[model samples]
Target: MAGLYTDQLKLGLDDVGWVFAIEQSGSIVGALLGFWLTPRVSWRPLIVGAAFLAAVANAFTANVDGFAALAALRFASGLGMMVATLVSACLLARSPNPDRAFGAGLTLNCLLNAVFVWLMAKLLAESGYAAAILSAAGLFGLILVLGLALSGDLRGDFEAPPATPESGAVRLAAARTGLAGLVLFGLAINMIWVFLERVGLSNGLQAGDLGNAFALGLLAGTAGSAIPFVVGDSGNRARMIAITTAGLVAGIALAWWATDYWTFVAAVAILASVWNMGLAYYMAMTAENDPTGRYTRAIYIAVVAAQAAGPAIAASLLEFSHIGTVFAISPLPAIFALLLVAAVAGAPRVEGSSLAR
Candidate 1:
């Protein structure tokens, strides 16, 4: 959203980067907090409180006068949202079919994002910045209600028995690899996503066309997420990740060469879909490999940290290089992530554990 309305926010390029950084920094902090506290406390109250915090923070953000104030509010909002997000991940990680669970979650998120983006674009056209901000706040307020209705502990049904020392070591090793891969994957995706609008504009697309393309791409991401849910346990998560990574690389390449609107749209849709699908599988892999929820909780921390770094790094690169150069560099992290996934796939499974469904 900040990417789409930099002018309205009175932000320069550096300011935009800082805005994303501050918000994601807050998310990293919140994820760490959730990691520490989730096992010690009731998640219901925490989620309820966080939802209220997000609602109030975003509501106040709509009226903030300056960049600093807005940034601070966004930080608070990020913290709240991250707490909620991590808790939800913890719940989903315990499901029997974690791949499908993660895919369903991703599908819902992408669908909502697509809807909200389209709505925000329309509202901004009619009502300006305050309304758009308020609309977001309203959504957060609704989340607060949903949070209130949620019952029981955030921990899910399946709690793996305490691991043996050797098994614990193995799980930790695999989890670390998965988390590292996720961080790299996130960096690759966001590097392109953060600059997509600018890329489109540079290619002579109008603002409306770009927004529409983004909305469509998000919808395609929704479809991508749904695929795993439809197929259930396909028993080929590593293969899926590999294929999606290749598709993402191709999407980036197409985006670099695309001069026409339709070509750019196709590129964005493919990128968005494959990125979401790949991350869903990656998340499922982490959850399944480490059922204790220890490493799974930390995944959000890595993700937010990478999201904070990717654009900042890309922004720096843009100072001395062409956008195409940055796009070319973007796929390297994803390729490395795929390699890590392969390693995880080939690792020996724990006794009585199933890698293939």
Candidate 2:
């Protein structure tokens, strides 16, 4: 919803780079902060606070009459969004059932995107951005109440017995793999959101058209998030990374190289699908290595860092070349990194390792 109405979010970001940086900066910062915050603070405050802040801060985005105000609001909102997501993911990680755990994550990413985008579009349609943000604020208030009231058993005290490895080396290896996998997954998302959006908009595409592209990509992402569940243990996650990276890169290439609108949209769809696949695999890798979600924060750190750096890198590329050229360098390098990091994945468990919260 907020995404569909780019025109409504008034900012003096004439340079596409400025807008991309503002948009991604919030997510990156939020992720970085949230990843670390949730492990210590109770999830309740983090969730509710983030939701309220996001609603209030985003509303401010509509009313920011100057660049500095807009930037401040965005940074605050980004922190809120990341904290909320971190709390949600932490909750999901703690779920007793594996299927439900992954399902929770899937639902968060998909359902929220669907509901909020629709609500935002509708609210913006009738009342404008301010009204739309106000609606979001109301929902956040409700969540705050519910979370405050009902978090009786949200935290899992002691984790399940650790998975003891035959060798300490095995534990060390798994930790390295999980970190590497996370970095790759983060990079893939960076390429699409930061670079792709800028490309579509400044390169003669309409707002509705870009919204549609994003919508389709998100839809594909939802579908692609199930690889780990299906592939199971002993699955070649490394190969999956390679395949997904290649596909995402191809999609980006299509988006950049294609002159026609539909052609570009098709490319975006491929990216949407492949990126989701990568995320699922990465999450699975993380869980396999750190079922407790303790190391999840560190994973979050890497994820945030990659997301932040990827966009800036892409934007810098655009400065020297065309928007297309910026997107040209993505996902593949990240994928190669995954191979180097998580290559020897199909191994046994380890103690104090998976960072099981």
Per-residue error (Å), model 2, residue 185: 3.6
Candidate 1 lDDT tens digits, 174-288: 6677678788988998888888888888888889888777766667667778877776567587788787889889898887777787888788888878877776777777877
Give me the runs in candidate 2 sitting further than 4 Å from their true place.
Answer: 1-10, 14-29, 59-70, 95-100, 153-169, 197-211, 226-239, 316-328, 346-357
**Model 1 per-residue lDDT at 300:** 87
Best by TM-score: 1
Q: Which pairs, if any, clash in model 2?
A: 1-117, 289-354, 290-354, 292-356, 292-357
Q: Per-prediction TM-score, please?
A: 0.88, 0.76
lDDT per residue as tens, model 2, 1-357: 334234554433463346456756788778777766665677777788888888787666666555566667766777777777667666655544333355446645676667777787788889877777666666666666766764755542425354555443455456456667667666755755656666676668887778776776676556555554455333455666677767776777777765557876787667766665665555555554554465655656677777777766766776778755555556566667665544454444444444211
Model 1 CA lDDT for position 61: 75
Q: Against the unseen true structure, what C-alpha lDDT does each candidate score?
A: 0.79, 0.62
